[model samples]
Target: MHRFVVIGGGAGGLELATRLGDAFGARRRNPQATVTLIDRNPTHIWKPLLHEVAAGSMDPYTHQLEYAAQAYWHGFEFQQGELTGIDRAAHTVTIAAVDDDTGREMLPSRSIRYDTLIIAIGSTTHFFNVPGADAHAFALDTVAEAERFRRRLIAACTRAESNDDALRAQGALPTHKRHRVQIAIVGGGATGVELSAELRNTAQVLSAYGLHGLDPRDDIGIVLIESGPRLLPALPERVSTETARLLEARAIDVRLGERVTEVAEHAVRTASGRDIPVDLTVWAAGIKAPRVLSTLDGLTVNGLGQLNVRPTLQTELDDDIFALGDCAACVWPTTGRNVPPRAQAAHQQAEFLFRAMRDRLSGRPLRAFEYRDLGSLVSLGHVTAVGNLMGGLIGGTMFIDGLFARIMYMSLYRMHIAALHGIPRMLLDTLAHWLRRRTVPRVKLH
Candidate 1:
């Protein structure tokens, strides 16, 4: 009986685990193989949606998948623990004990032996050691962090309004020019751009709740700061230009080529020694693999802490151990560029590895992982979206905006769901969410 364990219940790992379970978990009588998934969190949510969650535009609970429930439905065992280390020689993974809320030791620190191991622990925000960034700026990495940011946004708006009221009661000019909550979003990547737009939209939604006469275009100021010369530097030139145009039209101040030297409690100091005052700051700049990856006993990692994997997605030192997603450095065959750490690339890699694992189990040669060049998409809230279609599907460099790009961006998440739960279940969940959305408030006011 083969024992397979997948670490990290992220987009790539979760989907692959579900597929493997469906294939192996149902057969009870014929010496069925055991499949287990381990994650720190009890639930899983698409990482890209963290921006929306941070802006309070989407209810995360509705989108989150309970690991225990999904594991039960898909016929796999779900272990609630964090991986501390792996022993390749012993074919075992050491999991740290999870301390319960009541100070009880629910699960002891233990080792689980596996015939195959997949590491997909994902990445975290790279602050670049900017002064005060760790203490002042909010990062959108986890559901908890997003929710915290959302609450802070709402509170800032409320506090600004109250401050204005206090000045009014003191017999000052009614519109005596008080700055509203000014948000500074550092990093011009998709997460930073998308979050800025979503925050603006959420401000509009929040205005109805006692923010009388507050003009989104005037009172609420959003500044997107990028160290590079243009936004979305990784995307095509046209995509960045078009995106900048759309954002500027919405009254968002796009500051390009400005390096942030420091982050203060209420301001971001730029390399040019300009201190831009802000009420709320969000740092979406850069990313690096989880710190744990660098310390893996027999793994070689780059400066970014990403494990160096072969073309087959297996660790260079161990064939039984594989890695994917943001934590794995998989080289591109043609361009010689390591594959970009994007969700689409991770999904594609997961599917390839899934098939390769089954082949290896059946005494067949594993196929090399090939990366497909899928152009990027950036969603600027409900205002607009921009992207370039790849695979020559829409010809060379098709710059799409408005509805088309929005639909394309959404389909990416839908595709991930389809991979995990099948098309029928994904469609049902989509329809259910749509209907529920109509009856709920746009923002999570609570």
Candidate 2:
């Protein structure tokens, strides 16, 4: 019997595990194989929508998948624990003990043996060791963190609204008569940029609902600070330029070429000595694979702490071991560039590995994974979206925006839903979610 273990139940890992389990798990009674999925969290939330979670535009609880329930219905064994180490010689992975929210021990450390192992633990925020950055800035890596940020944002606005005189005296007024709650966001990547835009929409929605006393238009100040010259540096220059223009038109302060040297309690200090007052500071700067990657029992890791893998998605040192998603540094064979860590990439890799696993079980030749550049999309809240889609006259990417781009952007999440829960569940859930949204507040206030 082959014991297949997949660690880290992120998008790629969860999908792969569900498919593999459905194929070989007890429902089918395939005595030749067993599948298990291990993750620290009891539920799974799509990483891409985290910014929406942080900005209170979306409630994560409504979208999260209960791993235990998913496993029961889909035929995979689910284990909850943090990955601590891997034993290459014995083909075993060690999971650290976990405690409940009250600090009571729930489970002890254990090791699981596997004939085949897939590691996709995902990445964490890389603070770059900036002074006070880790201590003062909020990183949206988990649901809890996102919810915390949302609460802080609301609290900041509420406090500012209640103390207009103090704000006016402190020169926190955006204009002659209104005070703005200044939010400092570090990094102009998709998370930072999207959150900035979403927050603007959140302010408007909050104000219209009378959730706060301040004027949304005049009381919310957004300062997006990017060390780079423009936003979404990973994307095309045109996209970045248009995005900047859109942000500026919405009264957002896009500060380019200003590196944050320190994140203080109430402000962010830039490289050029400019101090930006901040009611809330969010650090969406950069990411690195979890530090546990470095301790993964002789696995070779790149500078980003990602496991080095061949095009086959097999770890360089061990064929029995494989990796995918943000944790794997797999170079695109055609472009000689490492695959960019994107949700699209993760989704594609999951599909590729699903087929690869079946072949391995049948002792067939495994095909190498090829990454496709499907272009990128950036959503500007409910207003619009901008992105470049593949398929043009010369086979180059074509820039797109407005209503069409928004539809395309939405389709991405719909696709992820379809991948995870199948078309029927995805469709039903979509309708249910739409109905629920009409009855609830547009943004989460608590």
Point to the candidate with the largest TM-score. 1
What would the per-residue lDDT of candidate 1 be over residues 1-446, giving only the tens digit for each residue?
Answer: 78889999999999888878887764344535788999988999999999999989889999999999988888888898888998889999988898888989988888899999999899999999999998999988899999998888877888777777788898774653535779999999999999988887888888776544467668889999999999998998898999899889888999999999999999999999889999989999899998988777788998899999998999999999999999999899788889998998889888887798789778898888988877899998864689888774655666688988898999999998898788999999999988998999888887
Extract clashing residue pairs from model 2.
none
Quick one: best lDDT, which candidate? 2
Residue 291's lDDT in candidate 2? 91
lDDT of each: 0.88, 0.90
Model 1 TM-score (2 dp): 0.96
Q: Candidate 2 residues 219-273, lDDT tens each?
A: 7889899999899999999999999999998889999999999999998999999
TM-score of each candidate?
0.96, 0.96
Instruction: Go through the candidates in order and give the C-alpha RMSD of each one to the true structure.
Output: 1.7, 2.4
